[model samples]
Target: MCWCGIAVSQILAVRVDLWNNGNLVQDIFLGEIKVPVKVLRNDSFQAWYLLQPRENGNKSSKTDDLGSLRLNICYTEDCVLPSEYYTSLRNLLLKSSDVQPVSASAAYILSEVCRDKYDAVLPLVRLFLHHHKLVPFVAAVAELDLKDTQEANTIFRGNSLATRCVDEMMKIVGKHYLKVTLKPVIDEICESPKPCEIDPIKLREGDNVEINMENLRYYVDKVFREIVRSSISCPTLMCDVFYSLRHLAAKRFPNDPHVQYSAVSSFVFLRFFAVAVVSPHTFHLRPHHPDAQTSRTLTLISKAIQTLGSWGSLTKSKLSSFKETFMCEFFKTFQEEKFTESVKKFLDDVSSTESKEPSGVSEPVHLKEGEMYKRAQGRTRIGKKNFKKRWFCLTSREFTYHKQQDKEPIFTIPIKNILAVEKLDESSFNKKNMFQVLHGEKPLYIQANNCVEASEWIEALCRVTRCNQKRLSFYHPSAFLNGNWLCCKATTESTEGCARCTADVPADTQIEIDGDRETERIYSLFTINRSKLQKLEEACGSIAVYQGPRKEPDDYSNFTIEDSVATFHTLQQIIDIVEKLNESHEKYQKKRSSSAKYGSEENPIVGKVS
Candidate 1:
């Protein structure tokens, strides 16, 4: 009989023991059968049976056939097999229709067989999804969908297949489907734009849309939980998803206070999440880029500060707390010098333009002397009988001087009538003996025979004056020698020209006269003592005299020569010296206190310095 003509029962019972080197690997059995009698008629005709190992004796259902097959044949001991046989066997095992005894084992087998040929499996999974009501089949299809998304995405870029699979899964499991579907979507969204169309109306009507505070809160909480559960190893992707969701939440429930509050709250949690996820070693990475997650975190903080600052009713305590939180976080991140440039740019972008000065406060002004005019000087009438003209002049030291120019004793002299008025330096009045010719304790007098002689005498007296005095009196020769004298006394108290003296004189009292044929004769005269003049000069230089009446006797008496000179230093220089001393003293005190407080060997001065 030919090999092809052999009956099923006539096939040989084939048994094979397989080994690697000397180790016994496996034993496999082929069905009992017989070898054909006429098989040798064909040159290539050989009766052979191949035996393959099964997992658990259930040959039809096993997934992995680990052991090699053995063959019962009439050929030589070392027969060569064609490679096509192994290829055909693999193809047969992989076909879903050929898998018998349907079980998880068979499913495992099918998964492995079709692992590389996803296109081939796609058709069968589609068939199962169409015809099967089995939950396992649905789960299997969902797994297949997840596994094939990248391929499906590439194949159907703008179509509905990708979204359809997700929608079906979600419908089957409700909210729980998120646990299965979110990760793939997160990855996809991060990698590319939303591939599937989202129904804006449906999303708006969803549980997240409820304006009630509690419902919104619940929705936000759920979304946060989902995000937290996702594997966000890729921070860039994580950040993209975060910002997308935040953008959605913000758009959908913009007017909802609770939604706004929850969105900001979620942002805060996300920041902390990034901080926790980033390793200390890699913490400094991408600080400038800061991913979308960190940007959202900073933006939310800024918004909170702005909202509180703007809200008229926000309490001071709440505002303070908000500021404190923002400042603390800002400073912590900003302390790093590497971030300074970027931080400054961000601050400039977000900072308010209006000045921070408080409302209702006036701007400060600087006053100067030229802004106002000086007051005119006025005089008081003296005694009930007469009014004296007096004016005030400002001295270089800023002191005011009251003077009656006409009352100056020198104004009444014959020289005053003879000489033209001359403007002298103001310092001329400050000379030691200038005022002594007018008034002093010891007065000088000259006796002249006539007005021409007196004019000549007055000019000589003015030239020889050497001390500042309170008054000077002029005497006529006849009046002085006969004891009937006309004396003109200079007084600062005079309201008019030096108290005028009119005295009748004896004609015969011709005091000693110097001979000058063309000029008037000279007369007897008295001079102030030389020692008294010297004393007066010393007193004038040492004392600071005021033109006003004395209020206290000791005011002038107690002043020392040195005190006046010392008082003339600039106020600023004095203050600077005092400040330097104070600073040095304070520094010393601080050093001593610090040393005592720490009492370390490095600070040995703690006890010894004090």
Candidate 2:
């Protein structure tokens, strides 16, 4: 499965290094195998490459015989076409909001066809979210999942489409929230390792049992404090999703008092924060894997967090399910009520309406940041000034630029105030690679080092604010210079813009997903997994036709298909769409091949993913 995330060209190289029992590790270059990043780009490329001396090797001779190493590289790039290509599929998905029983929707049907519900859920969530239809679909599916629930404890416990969607949603929106909340302490614990093992059997000889318990207590307390204190930092979108889950869970299990807490905690704590604590590298909290000692320490902390997350279950020492008496006893030492109160409050904050700006949060998401020259907004019309090089930073909340990197920003523009961001006419600024940001009354003019940077900055600005309500409907393409709006030639600075804005995307939109790109990826998945989809189609037909006692399910039983008729109908439509898409792809491929020149070079990333 592929995710829309960052990718960099990196070729693995093996170098000689000393591994002294995981201690005193240093660069001891021995041999190397270099594979071009291009090879992995087209598809997974596996081959045996001979190791040779490093090009910069000063300590080795060419006569050195480095052994051969077998490399298996698996990677893929989805070449998404234009938005028009995906319109039909997008229309069907847009109607997901109105899909009765919700299970009949295109998005939900996609999940039923895939093995890992996540593969379908991730893109579906993003697509529905972009079109502002996620909450309804999630709520509908969750209600379906809740129908089979006999106990409050199991609410959202299953790896259903609804659950997976929520998981991906949190991971998408709460990425920055997690970093702000847990990364600091996670890094502290990793950089400074301390034994938190309270298990007597696991403790090494000469280790102070009391000291270990105290260390464990210290870490748990620190982590808990951060979790509770950072509640306001939760993303608004996550809050909405959690709020829906809590509301639905509570509604379904009206008699169960703690179901609401469990509904939110099941993901926020047990899944999100605690999981990140145990595996910091996976969450990008740390640069690399922690050492053995640090890893052990993190595991202990993660365990404590998970138990504490279940505030109600923590009341029963026996039900806490501690494997060892020491751990159970150590948990007794915890201020159980305080931790419980913290968890309760944190859940409340997250499920409630998030504040405008997260309080006490210094590190907002650094979206796209670099150094650029910004021309001063000179008060006098006649005075000329040179552009001042400044470090500009954009986050979800605001855009600010500083006199120096890592210093106080000289200017700040709240995301709401950004009316428009567009390229400035070269004639007005008399410079290439110039753009302007329309805010309150004045415009901020900036010059990038080059054209690509200029386009990137503009795209990022518009991308982040595309959904902003306050974004102007129109704007002056040229800068407002010498007391005139250059593009409109309007006398008043605040006159209505002469040109309409390109994007009216909601100002409150939290995530920016490429609808066409996600649609293309889903189409590709269907093309590759056509056989599995056909099997599902037949299974849906079988189940709908055979209204008898549920017999043994075939291959499609692996997927959750609650409504066979609805699923079958959706599957038929999807098959039709996929077939059409496949035909288009084939035609495009044929056209390209027909136009190919003799001995012409194609993609250098040789071979498809294997």
Model 2 poorest ten-residue lDDT run: 1-10
Models 1 onward score TM values of 0.13, 0.69
What's the TM for model 1?
Answer: 0.13
In model 1, which runs have C-alpha deviations exceeding 4 angstroms?
A: 1-110, 115-122, 134-610
* Candidate 1 minimal-lDDT segment of 10 residues: 517-526
Local lDDT at 543 for model 2: 80
Q: Which has the greatest lDDT? A: 2
lDDT of 1 by residue, 401-444 (tens): 13443232221222111111111111322211111122311122
Report the CA-based lDDT of candidate 1 relative to the real structure.
Answer: 0.27
